[model samples]
Target: MGLVDTLTKSARRSSTTSSEGATMAAGYSAERAPDGNPDDTEVLDKEEGNLVMALISQLRIGMDLTKITLPTFVLEPRSMLERITDFTAHPELIFGAGKIEDPKQRFLHVTSLILAGWHIKPKGVKKPYNPVLGEFFRCTYHYEDGSEGYYVAEQVSHHPPISAFFYVSPRNRVIITGELKPKSKFLGNSVATILEGEDRVRLLDRPEDGEYTITMPNMFARGILFGKMLLELGDFSSVRCPSTNYSCDIEFKTKGWISGGYNAVSGTVKGPGGTAGEIAGHWDQSMEYKDKGGRKQVLFDAATTKVVQKLCLPEAQQEPNESRRLWAGVTRAIKAADMEAATAEKSKIEEAQREKTRAREASGQRHQLRFFEPVGEKYMPNIGVDRQVSGAPLAKQSPDEMARTVKEWLFGEVSTSPSQSVASGTQATPLPPSASVSHFGSETATMASTASMQSLNSVAAVPVHVTAPGPPVDGPKLSIPPPHAH
Candidate 1:
């Protein structure tokens, strides 16, 4: 029998009621008495058993979950596109690049900023939706300095999923381009996801060409077999600036077999002439920096920093393909604790996508990526030039290699000006000033330079200024496109 059929039979054998099979199929919550509390110990135990059976069935289907259809209850109410915004939580670190001339200092600041951007959800185990091919999400950030920054992310590939993102700040004259290709493996009790791409940050106005290349650490979903589930970032990652000869190696420490540490990161920043700065801290909390002078200072404190809020048009005004707009029904259902409704809505979208894929295959057509194109082995903007820089490559090595590297840098002698190597196997060129201005998303080609969102029905209302200024206000009004003709 099929896995679903076996699971259904198992559910039926658990209880006398016919509703038990239906409940298991729908991932129903434990029944409650009129008082709104759980019904009884027997009912609770049976419900828990059903869930365990379902989880077992899911694992039996596949060890690699990349292509599997996960239940709606396990999904977080957001898309991967929305999750990428965590990088811009602190606008100062990005926009402040223009003020810092020293490459070493700038590299240090950028590394600290990148480490600070990892935000954990309230429920640590919930997963974000796997974006559909050609799906796009866009939003803008209004900084306290009255300057605006825009971000765009697209799911540029499907077979081996890849997310391409670009964030441009005209006022700061900085651009961030990245491709995310995660390779995940499910261990018997835990899952490991390795980041298989590099991200580049370039300052457009800098006279000397330089770019910061960053690689993220691997992630782990632990405690799956028993106990409370937890998400932990493991292994190590680094940030390097090739032109400046300054580099930071960040080691994310995972807990050991017996006991060691969790969320702990320690690294050394090597600059020109053997000068080094020490960085050590917990990623979700705060980090400390000891400069070449050996004076220690708090680099970033997530607990105290006022994270900038991201702004996106309301769902009603968002394009059909925007993350919020596409997942509105599923999000509503999840929020209301209606798992059945959430599953149904999510299935509808997935089924539509599958049908489209079948049609494309039959017609010998392909789903064209709207916002990004494949660059080398990853997806990046087809437009724009690059600014070349030198830096040591962020190599993927075993834990022992990383430990030895860190130990040599810390206890043993090492070169201050390490020879630079390309992380993406190519040099990044900076975009020309004219090319800096671009649109927000694929559906709504609204000018990115415009502060106010374009409205189709009437003249856009004057935005009320708050603690921070909003987007620029001088462009033709635009509105969300009507739903795509499916």
Candidate 2:
């Protein structure tokens, strides 16, 4: 039978069964779970299969999917702004990276930290909710060593769908700032989310080593129209530090039709002199590093490492624009397996956003961002840091003072009591005309060109001698400017 015919038959078979076991076999039990964690292979129910078929009929081979409204079943019950926290899941790997004396070791530690993050995602082919403009998410991390980390992220732009975020662990002397602009497209039976952005990591204690810029790999959702839906990271990514002249080029290899394996990655670490080492293994399991001397060490093993829990205020305590509070109704409906109610709740948020956009266009007002500010084509944390000051650099600030400043900047006030609720800063303004109600812009559609596809496949061939200021020859180019240029 043809693929569509087989799906239809399966749906008909499922429709005839009234038993709870049959319903679970059709993925009903998984859908009703609060977390909605699916197995590696997701089985769509009759209703879901029909809905997906209808949606697929409307899509072109290489069409941009940013503006398309996806089914609620595919949602992960969290905003993209909050989902970005997955990158910093393992605080143990990142907190002490800067303290490593040797540049090569530090670079390797950073690479391991990057690779470790990809394994913490929710199982199944799921995507986080596209955050609305001006919506924000913030949380705190309490490390085992008694130190704390703070993270804040905001959807600063809507049309291009840019999420700017900041993370700092003052006691650990680490600061990370970055932006994510995800451009999704329908590629035949698969969908790809081109991760267009970079993370700038600064080791406050090791200022002389400078900042490390890390690029991201693109995400691919395979077998969307047939077979079992699966998520894979494809193409090239890199971690580079200019001051130390050290870099690591990583390739997230996708599984081929009849060969290859899922989550496989290979990388080369280069220093100022030449190639320093090589790394190989699966990103979701374990990775190993080998130095020039043939000395090998396990870089990261996901099975042994525990992800630190993040603390967020209760939904009732959160501001109206906070990610959890903003999507509470939709989340509750999804958890209860009420697709109709979920759709209605989701539509309310989307329609409210559209109304705000229309009102802004009519009033000729631009969106006023809360946590981040645009610096040229990039965005930076608006922590009120004065670079013009003669001698006092940001690196010299005490950890307590730095944390206080960041807290005030994010919450609009500094509170000493841990039990006190921190109010979210000023009410958000509507986005500008260019940043419409659409999730992403027209530029995303152009990213599916032949040239980009070729680049994605040839990542291993990229030259190692490239400097931090220059973009890599293979894969998606990083758009972040040089360190401290802002």
Among these predictions, the greatest lDDT belongs to: 2
What lDDT tens digits, residue by residue, belong to model 2 across residues 1-486? Answer: 443344334434444444343344334211111111245546566688677767766776678999999999988788888878877776555555565566776676667767877876655688889999989988765443345577899999999899999888776678888999999997654689999999988877688887799999999886454445678899999999999999988999987645677789998999999999888999878888888888777777766656655556566657899998999999999889998899999999999999999999999999999888898877887774435233344457676666556655655554421211223452221111221111011111011112212221222221111111111122111121111100
* TM-score for candidate 1: 0.70
Where is model 2 more than 4 Å wrong at Cα? 1-38, 385-394, 416-486
Q: By how many angstroms RMSD does model 1 differ from the true structure?
A: 16.6
The C-alpha stretches of model 1 lying farther than 4 A from their native spots are 1-49, 58-62, 382-459, 462-486
lDDT of each: 0.58, 0.68
What's each prediction's clash count?
Answer: 15, 0
Q: In terms of TM-score, which candidate is strongest?
A: 2
Writing each residue's lDDT as its tens digit, candidate 1 over 1-486 gives 764455445444544344334334334222111111111001323454355446645664226668767667667788877777777666555444544555665676578667867643434456687888778876655443334556778888777888899776655566788988887775533567778787888766553647788999998765333323567788878888888888877999877654565678899888877658788888877787776676776656666655555555456655677778898899899989887899899998888778888999999998887666676775655433342112221122222232223223321222211111112443322211221222111222112332221111022222211111111222111111111111
